[model samples]
Target: MRSLLARLSLLLVAALVAGCGADASSAEFNGVRLEQPYGVPDVPLTDTSGASYSLKEDREDALTIVFFGYTHCPDYCPLVMGSLSAAMNHLSEEDRERVNVTFVTTDPARDDEQALRDYLDGYGSEFVGLTGDLERVVELAEPLHIYVADGAELPSGGRDLGGHTTATLAIGEEDEAVALWKQDTSALEYAEDIHALLADD
Candidate 1:
């Protein structure tokens, strides 16, 4: 009886270990899957200060979040930025330092150098606002799967425009977009995702 009990106990222990390993491999939070391998493309952009920035160069040993929206976006732009700010507030100083948040305006005409700078100033200094030549902007937007339609006919004097998608991308250290968080997602959720990426070895 003792020998049989010992064998059963070992089997139970092995089963528990296997289950724990599976759970860890399938780690997820708030319905967001935490395991995926992807990357962001290398694109050249001009910052609000007219300085050139390449996605490959700007990427360091941290996670970078990129959002494509114009300054004139009445609802989405500010809301997303605000949520991002809130999410940053929840992170530790080290994690915050390991994260780069960029706001790229699709409307280069109105969101000129100074205009882009001023708009991002309302957020945080760490937040970078990038806008460059229209042609370059279109080229950069293509690979990201973002489509911006010229909406010069809406409220507020027909300055309204829409994009193909309202999504923010999370780029890992290798310049690859690891995950995409939609505009409707909460800041806390965004923070969690960033934390997960940071924790990944």
Candidate 2:
């Protein structure tokens, strides 16, 4: 688990290090910019509401920020979600309405529909939760540079999590990935970045 966290840490630092000059004219937050745009895969999955939906079908007007994590994560998952919750609150009512935060679990075996609903409600009802084929989930996240690491379950029952990346991917109005926010990034910075995206298009 520590190794997984370390991997995410290094990737984020690398991203922050790269593309620093690319968005200097307008970027309000320090996040890695992909060399090429990545579109959300049309992978089929079930939302918390049990309806059929795909990331590709989410709103085009809204800046969709997707996090690939599990509900059972002892620390990182909740922390990132909390940051998003606070960040969402900071947006103006108009901008907030244009932001959609979706949580897609890397551990579909455990994050059942009821569990997802309960877990996401802690952040906000507006947050969407999706749980389905782990492989499909991986396919959806791989291009964005997010992958899951499933550690062995402890004797007590909960499994250790391992994921290659721990960044919230912000999809732009063009439906292409624009930024990657590390898990520990401040809520205020997230709010600012979201606003910046809205201002751009």
Best by TM-score: 2
List clashing residue pairs in candidate 2.
149-162
lDDT of 1 by residue, 1-201 (tens): 999999999999999999999888655643244256454556788887788887768656488888888888888888889988899998899999889788887778788889888888888877888887666765666676555444443342322336446778777776667677777888898888788878984
Q: Cα RMSDs of all predictions?
A: 6.0, 11.2
After TM-score superposition, what is the CA distance of residue 172 in candidate 2 from its true location, in Å?
1.8
Output the lDDT of residue 166, model 2: 81
**Stretches of candidate 2 above 4 Å error?**
1-27, 149-163
Which pairs of residues collide in candidate 1?
39-176, 39-177, 40-175, 40-176, 40-177
CA shift at 181, candidate 1, in angstroms? 0.9
lDDT of 2 at 73: 84
Q: How high is the CA lDDT of each candidate model?
A: 0.75, 0.79
lDDT, residue 48, model 1: 72
